[model samples]
Target: MKLKKLSAQCLLALGSLLALGAAQAQERVTAAIPGVVNAGTPIEFIQDGFKGTEGPIAAPDGAVLFTENNNARIIRIAPDNTTSVFLDNTNGANALAYSPEGELVAVQTIEPRVGVILPQGNARTLAVKVDDSLGFGRPNDLVVDKKGFVYFTDSGANGAVKPDPTKTAAPAVYRISPEYVIERIAKDITRPNGITLSPDEKTLYVANTAGEHIYAFDIDAKGKVGPRREFAHLEGLRQTENGPSSGADGLVVDAEGRLYVASNTGIQVFSAKGEPLGTIALPKQPQNLAFGGPGKKYLYVVGRGAVYRIPTLTAGYAGRAK
Candidate 1:
């Protein structure tokens, strides 16, 4: 029945796109430097010599923000190609999203918690524990919609024992409404990790790190997740001198609705129909990416100790916001 429901949902989504027109449904982009993965396209290494980084979120003013997990700091890559610390003394700020009202919402990597930080640098705890009952193992990635609702993933077996195997609740995706109420969306996903929303705010794409797959969820008017569907499957590609297989990690969506996935090989682009489009080679294995700049044509990519940007065909969330 799950398979059938997903088939129906895909058809419905495709039909909705058709109703809108094909020109708006698909977008194509390539690296600015043809094939060389250089920093010419404002590919600035904001800070170097860090353990790792991920979850690049684009703010309103064409600034891109990402988490330096090893250093427990959130850094901003300015539009001028400079870098500065947005938040410090943060505990493993892994994935972050900007609310409709411009608040920075983050999934704490070290602690099993979600926090909301204001532009003035004030941080407030939102949801500390899952369901207000079970202790969280790790709260991984998050994304927010235009309606001020936040959707996040919790992989409950980070270091601790799997939480309740019989229930398949160890790895799950959740949604938090504007009123601050929380609800579990999907609990059976294998290692739900990186997450983002479609440009139309109708679909949710989640990456399962261990499972090596990206899953999709249809979000309804009430913010309810319909069912689980496979968005993309990652096979272990040829390993580079840098690290592991092209295991998929973080995800971001463009104004044209294409999904940009951070993988070991580089950045993988996929259409809304789950078709493999192309790959953007990186100097190093990128951990995450975001679109920024004046027209949202710049792609900001993050690696271990560096960040880079290239020109893309589609504008980013920042440009789209306007």
Candidate 2:
């Protein structure tokens, strides 16, 4: 009788421990920004073992697409959570955006160019040289405006790779007009990694991975930006041997004009005017994110060779897929 009683006690303790573990896991998926995300919403791990994941964007059909840069391909995760290769031989593409004409525009880093990579056979280059002489300095991310203007960022030389004065251009943001004219828009950024526009397309936001602030630019009707301003101060910035790194990578705007940033802390939420709403912590540091799934109510995040998704109370901006 004593043996049976001790066994029952052990079983009860195990069940209690399991319940505690599950509750702790749910607590981690916090919905600090009330309407954006609800409390106790679980962040579901979809897949893992990616070579390198970045630049997640939503598809027109309610699927989420992201790049595995190290594998040189783009993967699509359907609403049902199944995965497939959307595009291959991406030339080391990192970030992706859909053009007004529904073409897949990407920032290719192998040859370091920005262009259309889809409708596959008809892929063409949009911009290659930063000037009449020098080439781009590692094109990082891009976003296509409504007028078909491709705005992208060149991250410049990183780590041991020193910039060659005669060849590589400095870090800057460039806009390729519909007429194929390459114009440098901003050059003062320390390290611009992710790029996005507001719901109205009147404001541009760029993430500085090496800095604590996400910069914003005022855009005119002619696509000319007034000046770069410190928009929102990011959380979870830490000093490293290389320098201060916030790990701010991807920017996406919601339908309500709220801005979401993928940073070292997790997904940082900000108001349309750059106010801190709160943060949604993840199992891994998110590198990029997008809203997809049915009704575009799912937030898909990719980083650290894994992909995760959580149901959001809000939908993504339907104006553009980012």
Candidate 3:
């Protein structure tokens, strides 16, 4: 039944492109994978040696902002390729996004906080303990829905992140609404890490780093999550340093509904229906990525203390928001 529903939706999405005209759907990009990134495009080095970068989001001015997680700062790469410090003492801005109102929201976990970057480049903690709850376990990655609600993952079991029978519960996805009300939507993923919503805004996707699988959930109008189902799996990963299979870390979906997953090997691209599309290998496994440039034509990748840029044929979902 799940496969049938997904197959119908996949065909519907293709028909949506057809209704929009082949030009708008970018039929030329089909030369690559059916719906992933453009193949044969050379990925160029933009900068390197940052403090283990993540959250390479693009600023409105076309500059890119990524967190130097180790150094606890946000670095900006200008359009001219020059790098400089953007914000200091970020509290550990791991993954970032922009609100429709132009505020910068972050998963600042060093202090175990979810906050916003103020206009003057200061940090403001929004929710520290979800209204006196058990406090955030380890807020890893997050995404902001079109309505400014944030969905983040809190992998319950920390400490080397290895699977153990002693672990009581799986990681969970929390929904922080536009009004700042926090709620736990799902809690079955083991070590959920990266997260993003579908292009149609009807589904939410999450990467379970410990489970080595990616899951999807139907999202309602009120930011509530429905049933969870398997979306994709991280393939060909050898055992990690900690006696476990490599898992999906960060994730993003393109306007064409292609899911880009960050894993130990590289960025794994999958179609809307959970079929393997292709892989874009990096020098080192990327931690996260964001699409930017005019019309969202470029992908800015960051990981292993470096950043890379490559042109893309499809626009990114909500990537151009202020």
Q: What is the TM-score of each candidate against the true structure?
A: 0.77, 0.89, 0.81
Q: Point out the higher-scoring one by TM-score: 1 or 3.
A: 3
Over 4 Å off in model 3, which ranges? Answer: 1-39, 121-123, 156-170, 240-244, 318-322
The candidate scoring highest on lDDT is 2
- Alpha-carbon RMSD to native, per candidate: 17.2, 4.7, 15.5
Q: Sort by lDDT, best first: what order?
A: 2, 3, 1
TM-score of 2: 0.89
lDDT per residue as tens, model 1, 1-322: 9999999999999998896774332222345422222333333334455666777877767677888877789888788877888888677878888777777788876666788866656667777666746656678788888887788988775633344444333667888888888888888876677788888788899877656568898878876678888888665564445333446778887776778788766788787787777677665677777777777777788876767777765676552332
Model 2 spans > 4 angstroms off: 1-28, 159-166, 241-243
lDDT of candidate 2 at residue 280, scale 0 to 100: 90
Write one digit per residue (lDDT tens) for candidate 3, span 135-209.
Answer: 665677888767788888876646333333243334678888878888877876667888888877788898877
Over 4 Å off, model 1: 1-47, 119-122, 157-169, 235-246, 318-322
Residue-level lDDT tens digits of model 2 in 1-322: 9999999999999999998886565345676577798787888878878998988988888788999998889999988898999988998898999999999999987777898998888789998887766887678888998889898998886622344657888889888988999888888888998899998999999999989999999998866788899999999989988678899988888889899999999999999989999999998889988888887788899999989898888898887886
Q: Candidate 1: give its CA RMSD in angstroms.
A: 17.2
